[model samples]
Target: MKKVAFIFPGQGSQKIGMGKDFFENSDIAKDMISKASERLGINFEKLLFEENDKIGQTEYTQPAILLVSSIANAIFKETSNIKPEFVLGHSLGEFSALVSAGAIDYLDALELVHKRGKFMNDACAGSGAGMMALVGLDDEKVETLCKEQREKGLKVWPANYNMDGQLVLAGLKADLESLIDTFKEAGAKRAIVLDMSVASHCELLQSAVENLRPYLEEFLIDSFEVDVISNVTAKAYNTKEEAIDLLSEQLINPVKYKHSIASKDEDVDAFIEFGNGIVLKGLNRKITKKPTLNVSDMTSLKKTIEALNE
Candidate 1:
């Protein structure tokens, strides 16, 4: 039997008018957006469709992306006969996966992610921490370079171990700048810091994790009904407690995404990225070399289901 998996996108994938199609066409999608707006105390529809740059702000972006992805997933579940054998999410996308897997309620996940974005944004507001993408460099070399940079008082570390040759680093601005020269000298194809505000997946975000812990604990998590891969440990979480703790720790740890997808059972036939953008699809192809599809709108969803049926 060919198994299927659903993967959710993270912060960087959010764009204005992301889920407008579903919102206008499906009542289920509209209700989800409305509930998210009430729970988050903001107009999600306006922020998502009307505002051009406002939604990109971390506080709004995190929860907005989650809400859209979850709504899209719900639409698929309600409309299709296909069910995933497992679910995975990238970085902040992990919360969406957990919600879809029945480990946490959608309202809880939405509220938690809103707070998470705020905590992260505030934690690095004035500290000058940020992230960088290093292309064409092996993970081992990146790890070694981070170690060397940290010793030089720059406080840089690997944030996202994305693939065999692509890695993202996070740390103080000065440290990242210093490493750029070293990476280039070491024959790296390109090393550039992302324009993001927070240095996620690094110890620098420990303050954010501390602030988010209490909020996470308040949410009631039930036993997981489906396997949800964790970004922190890169493994499937079996229990509710493990899921909660892993999510809390995810803020302060490297997103071991390469390991998470790699460890999935070999029986998985296809990986469906259930939201905007093809970032996860590209990453999955690099990691597993399997067929992948991106379900962003009705057209893509229909095409994916049709292909699966064939």
Candidate 2:
């Protein structure tokens, strides 16, 4: 069998009714959601199914997305016999990756990200931080431009190494608010300021990194059930010791997803995003010409299984 890598998405992928079908149809999935609600003292079904702003808030969004993605991963395991050769997650999705690898306990991963979200939200409460996607500029140009702009007091940094020409920049809201024209003037096709209030995977979340250290120290994580890639380093997290500091530093460092994917491209034959939305599949299309799938629901799952089986 050719190796397959499973990539789990981060915070932005969450939506209402993401895993409602799994919760309704599978005992294991139902028990998982129920446990999450009981443990977090929040009604996941209500928060995830209803039309509310709570799902948009970081504190609620983190745990909710984690539960749904993990449950989806669990359902994927139950419904199919295929096993992924490598696993990775982007930013908040790293917890889901760790859970898939068995490096972090599922419930512990859930609670940790919950607190992690609160810490990040608390850290950014008054900073007026923000992020934007700068498309059509290569990594070097974007990095150089961001560095130059930062010195001029805009303080922008490339936050996500998404692909060849797509970079997500994070910095102060006022600084990013003005970069639209400047980037377009500098040759960017589009400078889309994201709706996110928190500047994730950047120095803005340094306080969250500090606040999350203790939880990492306390958690009794097991060795990997499957090899997992790191977000900050874009390398394999071969041991639990490496995972702890990297997980904490993820809040403060840029997400090097392009490098991580490149590291596995030669080794893996298929790339599957096993969570909400087809974000990673689109990203994979940008990163490589691999056969990719997004298995968030029944349709995508069936398609992925059929392709992989064939």
Candidate 3:
């Protein structure tokens, strides 16, 4: 069997109708969604299947994405016996990874991330929190510039180390906006401020870190069935104690996505992404030469099973 690592996508991958195919076709998916709706007291069928604005709200977005990702993984597992070498997720996707690793129950994870989103929203509310995407600039240069800005009392910090030439910065909206031209002049092909109210993966979220800890303790199991890569360290960990520490710290630390994939790519022959979109797959193309397949819907699910079986 081909050794594979399972990856999940974070916040930006959500859409209006993700996982509808699974819900419609698989009894397991339907039951999972129904149970999540009952567990959270929010109608997930309406939240996920029908068009609505709540899906975009941070509190709702986190769980919705996780539910769909979890459902995809569940349905895929029903068909394929191939176990992953490890599991990893980006940002909010880490909770999804934990669910896949059997470190947390999916129902508990749904509630955990829902509260996590609320904590993050409360932390950043009215704080002018925001993020910026930089392309074509070297990591060292971006880090240096952000450090200089911080020394000057700006809140800017590198948030997501997505790939070699791409990085995301989180800080006060005004601070990130003010540095756009600076990054552009420093050889960045593009430095655009994202339309985000939550400055994730930065000290701006320090408050959310503590707020999320108790829930992490309540939801996570003692150990993982499969090792999960940490976004904070780009290393693998399995115990719930480590998960609580790292996941809490993750709220205030930049995601080491590129480093995680590049450092561990050789351990797996390929990657299978179980989620709504191919967001991480796109990044893997640049981070490592290993093939990245996705299982988002029934068609892709069958295709991925077939490919992996061969």
**Each candidate's lDDT (Cα)?**
0.85, 0.86, 0.94
Best candidate per lDDT, number? 3
lDDT by residue (tens digit), candidate 1, 43-67? 8889889966768788888888888
Give the backbone clash total of model 3. 0
Predicted candidate 2 versus true structure: per-residue lDDT over 1-310, tens digit per residue: 6578889888788898888877777898789988888988988889887888899999989888888889888888888878888899888888898888888778988899899999999988988989999889988988888888878877688899988889999988789978889899889999998998899888888888889998987774757888889898888875777888899888888999989988889888988887789888888887887878878877777888888888
Q: CA lDDT of 61 in candidate 1?
A: 87
| TM-scores for every candidate against the unseen true structure | 0.96, 0.96, 0.99
Q: In model 1, which range of ten residues has the least summed lDDT?
A: 216-225
Using TM-score as the measure, the top candidate is 3
Candidate 3 accuracy as lDDT = 0.94
Question: What lDDT is reached at residue 209 by model 3?
Answer: 85
Which portions of model 2 miss their true places by more than 4 Å?
none
Return the clash pairs for model 2, or none: none
Shift in Å, residue 10, candidate 1: 0.7
After aligning candidate 2 to the native by TM-score, how far in Å is the CA of 68 from where it should be? 1.2
Candidate 3 lDDT over residue span 1-310, tens digit each: 9999999999999998999999989999999999999999999999998999999899999999999999999998898889999999999999999999999999999999999999999999999999999999999999999999999999999999999999999999999999888898889999999988999999988889888999998889986889999999999999999999999999999999999999898899999998898999999899998999999999999999888888
Query: Positional deviation of 143 in candidate 2, in angstroms?
Result: 0.9
